[model samples]
Target: MAPGYALALAFSVALLVTTDAGNPGLVARITQKGLDYARQQGIIVLKQKLSTLHLPDYSGSYDVGVLGNVDYDINSMVVTDLQLPSSEVTLLPNVGLKLTVSGAYIEIHGKWRVHYLFISSHGDFELKVLGISISVGLSLGSDGSGRPTISTADCSAHISDMQVHFSGGLDWLINLFDDTIASSLRDNLQKQICPLVADAIQNQLEPVLRTLPVTSNIDDVAAIDYSLTGPPIVTAENLDVQLKGEFFERSHRSPPPFSPLPLSIPDDHSLMVYFAVSEYLFNTAGFVYQSAGKLIFNVTDDMIPKDFPVRLNTSSFGKMIPQISKMYPDMLMKLKISSPSAPSLAMKPGNVTISPLLDIQAYAILPNSSLAPLFLLNLSTDAVAKLGVNSSRIVGHLELSSITIALERSDVGPFPVQILSFAVNYYISHILLPEVNDILKNGYPLPLLDHIQLSNLMLKLNEHYLLLGADVQYE
Candidate 1:
């Protein structure tokens, strides 16, 4: 309790503190200030990572191994074989700093240990980086350049389980993966692997993130070559199309009549011609197409030169049928038509055999309804008729093979009157009974319809089309 005794006791304690090697339970306030300086370095690393990398807020736990050393002036001793357990590292609410280190472990030349870390800052990332090896060194000189950079050569680490979770929409996910999803997924995953992400953390980013695949549209859809799979093929709609083939045609005219009682059958005069087109298109009612299938001499607005030749292939029917079925599923119907045999005849007293292909176009109309509109589309072949000149007052023989008609529903709920499709085939022969004395010898006259017949044939006119159908009342 005396002043001299107290002074002596303090000196002894100080000496003991200075000499306390190989001793336990001794705590000393280091005047060296190494821990604070190390914290500043870690903070600097964080700032650089944020500003340059634009990283997302992160929170997780990590186990950091501690490596410490003791250094006084130029003399130094290295520390190793120190280990730490995993601890949580959370993002400081409202801060974006990622703290791999809450605090650091220190070893005085492999002799002593002390651990410490910070809580957090907002809008920053703080995380307990699992299995991260942390090393703290004492600087013996100014500028803190004497400490060693963390090197795998001096330490090691191992991890059992690891995972990462993030939130945001597609673009947010993009930035997380650094603007490229594939690259991001790869880099994020690689971040889990120890050395690459860890090693690159100081130099460059190598985070491998997992990515998902995408198909933007049908074009992106690729067909698998299963034996059953193929490029899409055409089917339906064009199943049954008649009236696009070779056809023999005949026309007849009647002579004048003067009898008052007016009950007389006129004589016959007819011409025979064959018609064909280069190509065909199954289209809207009477979408007449000619010119080798390319130039559409559409009957609606397209007028053909009187001599324009075109081929009408049955193939066009296949294309048209599918489209038509899609439009008129319920009301349209088709039935096949065929004749037993074609009739044979001569037009100009010469030997000629004409087998004409029959084609018909007709329409059906509902009598009374909102939809009671006219749908005049059909194809049919009439029975062969024969009349010739040698019977000379007679005409020709006519036969037909098949006919088809595709009718559309107008305002009518269903087609009201059906127009039977018909094809007419005919030829001229020498009339033996008439004695051949007339001015137009063996020469058959064109089936020129008289004014009465032409006037009697009723046809409705529209801005774009003219329709003729089944029960057309000649008005």
Candidate 2:
């Protein structure tokens, strides 16, 4: 592998490059291209190496440390008198040549630090980001092996710092919450890094003073360093705006224990159907929720009249008995409705947080949409018998292993919906407080991976998205 060989290719990133890609502008072109390349590579490396790179939580105050290694390729080069402090950072120690067609290899070699190249490490904060930060610096200079000779005054695109912040969604934030927002925030964060990267490149290459080809397309053929000025979009226009906030039990520790429910019910069961169903969803169904609370919901007045009577099912109640001895696993939650009067259902174990099994799916809608739920509900607890309005109540029981649903109508948009959510079923274990205690106590799905691989890590933008709508302000 060469020591380091980096070049810049500038497409119209919502700016105007009214100059040529000649020696005068080469510095800026190279610096910008170098920074661009470095950042892109950094993203891929970060994702591929996420398993190996561990980090500390930042929900509160905690110290973080940088512990990992990354590799890159460049021509063999060495630099002396480099001012950078970190020895790990590699930069231009050997100059590259771009020969002309006349001299076989029209190699164009110059003496200048157009873009400062060097690697340096810096401390980072979680910043309520609940993620980790990586900071690096780069510089450009001549290899120390050669004698001082008059060349171009090597300019430098000193990336004082380049960082990639990382984090897991809400589930990982706490054992109880199955926060779906975590994954959304992760994607938004990647977008936030784009502008910072663009600035880094601009700083490094603005002075290279190189000329560009005369083609109408600012996004030109592959070359080491390049520059163009036009209205077309580039990688720089992918913008994202995010507002991150979270609600968690700042106090960590198990909750006080509650006595088990009696396995009996009254003879009359009516108004208690709603609470019975709710409790069934939480305690029996092992649903994910923000906190442990009594089951609650409303039932159709006709479904159970004031004097309606029902009987409890004991024989069929033995099935679907989940181990209720674990704490609520870290998971994401969501409430979806499709109509105004339709009963709204809450789902647990977000797609991003839950285990690969225990199927749980969730989707979001706008303010006016209603909810349509499909679940084979089974409620057999003796608590349902006691939740009666008074006069009389029976332990109305329901048991179903699975419930499939079909949507009547929906107004949701093009945003992607993730249904492959599975959270560690902590509700059952949490309430039972004995069965799955071992599983929760240990914090499962332990790091079973040692290494990671990336076969086709790629980025391909469609023609429509490439048309940038912003300005480069390339001063």
Separately for all candidates shown, the number of backbone clashes (residues 3 or more apart, or on different chains) is 92, 87
TM-score of each: 0.15, 0.14
Q: Which ten residues in a row have the lowest lDDT in candidate 2?
A: 3-12
The digit string of per-residue lDDT tens for model 1 on 1-475 reads 2111211111111111011111111111111122233234434443343222222322222233352221111112232222333222222222211224323221212111112242221121111123334322211111121111221222122332222222222222212322122233234423433343244443531111001001111011111000101111111211110111111111211111110111111111111111111111001101111111211111210222233231121122213333323343333222121212222221122222223222222122123311212233332322222323321011233333333344433332354232222111110111111221122122222111121011111222212111111111111
> lDDT per residue, candidate 2, 316-351, as tens digits?
111121110011121122322111211112212220
TM-score of 1: 0.15
lDDT of each: 0.21, 0.20
